[model samples]
Target: MPILSRAALVEHLVRTRIAGDVATPRDNNLSHYRKLANGDRHYWLGLELGDRWTDEQDVLAVMAERCGVIDDPAHRTGQDTIDPELTVDGLERMAARLRKAAAGQERVLFATGHPGALIDVHSRVAAALRAQGCDIVRIPGGLVADEGYVVQFADVAVFERGASLWHTHSPEPMNAILDGLGEDGRPDLVIADHGWAGVLAQPVQDRVHGLRGVG
Candidate 1:
């Protein structure tokens, strides 16, 4: 596939329902937000929430600010929206990070929870970075329990040019990878989404870049 310009990418996001009238329903978002506010371990995805996030409204507010989701507490059902502008802004920011990594020949790791939708994008970026001499790190391991189901490490495949990830919402995979890092070892950059992104960002905020509100 051809690389899309910023404007073209924004249009693609909208047309694909990755942003603007997003496929994630408002009710589902509220349910997740409620779980987060209530301190549900499974939903927290390795984030350490402060006491101020005790209320669901507070979570909603934060989501709205970061993701451009509707802020209204009254929104109970139907399609939730992700502002295309916010999606574009996030993509641009990610692109800038990738550019820096390429320039520095940074060691980078890529993972995702929305593999069905986003693998192509990540693979292309990984290939580009490889062309620039960046080492794309491959995490090796086996299946691990997440919530209830087992997620295989092979499901998240690392190749010569890029990697392919399967769907996963739990942070366990990322935590395992971080735990196994060598002393004085850390990827210079991590590209990921959903819980994978959140977990990686917790310990090393500067080296991780991700899109918020993607399911």
Candidate 2:
């Protein structure tokens, strides 16, 4: 497939529900925002938020600024919006980081919670990085057993062209990956999203980069 021009990619993002009015319902975003404001650990996904986040309105403002969601607390239902400009900006930043990593041949790990939606993107990046002679770390056998349900590390593996994982919202997989990094080595950079990205950011704030919607 040919690479899309900037305009074409922007249009595709809107058409595919990856940008513009996102598929994530307004109610769901609001609920999650509320949980984030309340300092809910599950919603935080391991982020150590500051005291200023105690106000829900502040949280809404931040989300509005960063995610392009509706800022008005009164508007509670309908499709949530993610400004295409913000999406483009995010893409540009991610590209810059990837370029830097490639230049340095950085050891990297890529993972996602929204595997169904983002695995292709992550996998392609992984493949490109591998071609650049970057080390793509893969730690198998890390497992998270929560509430009688087990999430295997293999499920979240980001291989060259495909990822086996689907629908995971827990940070346990990332925690396991980090723990397994012990003496082997730590990834110089971690590209991830959702809970996986959020948790990665907590311990290695400087080295981890989080992508929205990919989680």
| The candidate that achieves the highest TM-score relative to the unseen native structure | 2
lDDT per residue as tens, model 2, 6-44: 788889989998888887998998888788888787777
Worst 10 residues of 1 by lDDT: 153-162
Best prediction by lDDT: 2
- RMSD (CA, Å), each prediction: 6.0, 5.4
* lDDT for each residue of candidate 1 in 1-215, tens digit (9 for 90 to 100): 69888789889999998888888889999998898888886677656565757799988998899889998999899988888988899878877877888898988777767667777777877888899999887664443434332232322322111233446666766665655554344577777777776765554443342322221
Residue runs of model 2 more than 4 Å from their true location after superposition: 1-3, 142-166, 203-215
Q: Please list all clashing residue pairs in model 1, or write none if there are none.
A: none
Error of 1 at 148 (Å): 10
**CA shift of 160, model 1, Å:** 20
